[model samples]
Target: MSQTLDMFATDDYPALTAGVDEVGRGPLCGDVVAAAVILDPNRPIMGLNDSKKLTEKRRERLFDEIQQNALAFCIARASVAEIDELNILHASMLAMSRAVDGLQRAGESVKPEFVLVDGNRLPKWHYPSEAVVKGDSKVPAIAAASILAKVCRDREMCELDKKYPGYGLAGHKGYPTKVHLEALKTLGVTDIHRRSYGPVKALL
Candidate 1:
């Protein structure tokens, strides 16, 4: 199967810049997570695909490698309350913006000439950006960003799981799985749950 995504590979752009991605946009609870990664084009990591395609263990391993090897990177998030107020789409864009902002604050030399973001929707940022479909699978930096965002969101869900035991957040990571929906039905919605989401809102 041809897994390559043409969006990132076809364009002969400037020097390899930063890639950004986010997770937890569809979750019933927790904040939107975003990561910005600037990779060394000369020393690219092998087997860099979408984080969703890799096992949790493999993704975790790659997470460390990406961190150690990346030229510059940053992970950022927008809270659940912020999502509720701005809506998930805008909140995710905001998180992506923050991640870029953080990278700029870290150092001027590390700033990106262009930002490659995963997914088709363009982020509402002033920076020069491109939105690529299936970018995480095609672009190494985007894939690294996906892994970082996923792991960070998973860690947050695990913490939430401890505070709210019955929800099984650690298992589903706030996704609307059958068990998660059942938990909502049985235990009622928690403060962390997104009241605007259809599945959780129906119960409310």
Candidate 2:
């Protein structure tokens, strides 16, 4: 017998429950961005899926849709300095916590009663929460959050690309791609490059 996973387990949660996700965890540069989204059950969004599985244009479109339709959403990030200081995993948790805090602040009247995080780990926080592996693909709210975080970080990378000019931050979004590695070897590590990471650490 095939075992089927329940994708909508969090649907029974309180109305104010939020979905949380982070982006840029695998990137060798740029801040890790996280988003918390409290979706309005009355307003369901279409075409929500993992940000990586969607085309850039599709993700952008859904990003706008999520911003306009979600009951509340907040984007937050841990900067390069924070990443270097605390390490990427803890920094990512810091970013996720900030995102949840921001969402609560933005929607002051209606705080989240619960939280569903995308990855297998949960940030140390007071909210009742559960971590769902690959939640972005299975949970609509997580999918929305993923798109928001991804788009926000990608835009920042584009700006960094303009400033840096050679690292292909815009194309690879600071990921340790072939072009990015070549550029790093040629131009050296920049301020935004995560010094704790192996490739960038080697260069330094």
Candidate 3:
């Protein structure tokens, strides 16, 4: 674990620092989900990596392990309406902030002193934070956050598929795929869709 971490560890984030990341940003439907995680150095989980790079089985296994082992974790989301109103970028930031703020309420710890977020932009908040380009692969906490958010969002997408049915939300995960585009034209757009998105907007 030490050997692998050496290749991807953050500069010098103190313990109890929260790592933040979001998922479902590129999906044409559903809320953008985010998660914040503060790992317990004493109870480390293995095989942490970018959620996109991990198999569903591994992510599912780690998902439970992280919740069981982390000092704190919180998952949050920005709704489709918020996406339409704020734009995806700001909405994603809002969700990320909500996640970190949630940790204060949800975690055993009072608060995280520092935050490391995946990607290049940090949410507008009071916390001391840095946005790492690929922090999901670089930081263990971020990787844990990545898994939580992805699994949570993907599960929601599956449930949403049941509700919305014909859009094939389960298979495409709400991405603007060829099948999704075809469904949009044939069956029409649902309220779950981000009306601000190009394909969705055209239909509206």
> Judged by lDDT, which candidate is best?
3
Candidate number with the higher lDDT (1 or 3): 3
Q: For model 2, how does the per-residue alpha-carbon lDDT over 1-204 read when each residue is reduced to its tens digit?
A: 001223566657888889999998899999999999998878888788888988999989989989988999999999999999999999999999999988843447346889999989999999999998888888888888999999999999999999999998889998889999999999998888999999999999
User: Model 3, which residues run further than 4 Å from truth?
Assistant: 2-5, 104-109
**Residue 9 lDDT (model 1):** 76
Model 3 scores worst on lDDT over the 10 consecutive residues at 1-10
What tens-digit string does per-residue lDDT give for candidate 1 at 74-184?
999998889989999999999998888777433553668888898999877777888888888888788889999998899889999999999999999999999999999
What TM-score would each prediction reach against the true structure? 0.90, 0.94, 0.95
Q: What is the lDDT of candidate 3?
A: 0.90
Which candidate order results from sorting by TM-score in descending order?
3, 2, 1
- Residue 191, candidate 3: how far off, in angstroms? 0.9
Candidate scoring better on TM-score of 2 and 3: 3
Predicted structure 1, TM vs. truth: 0.90
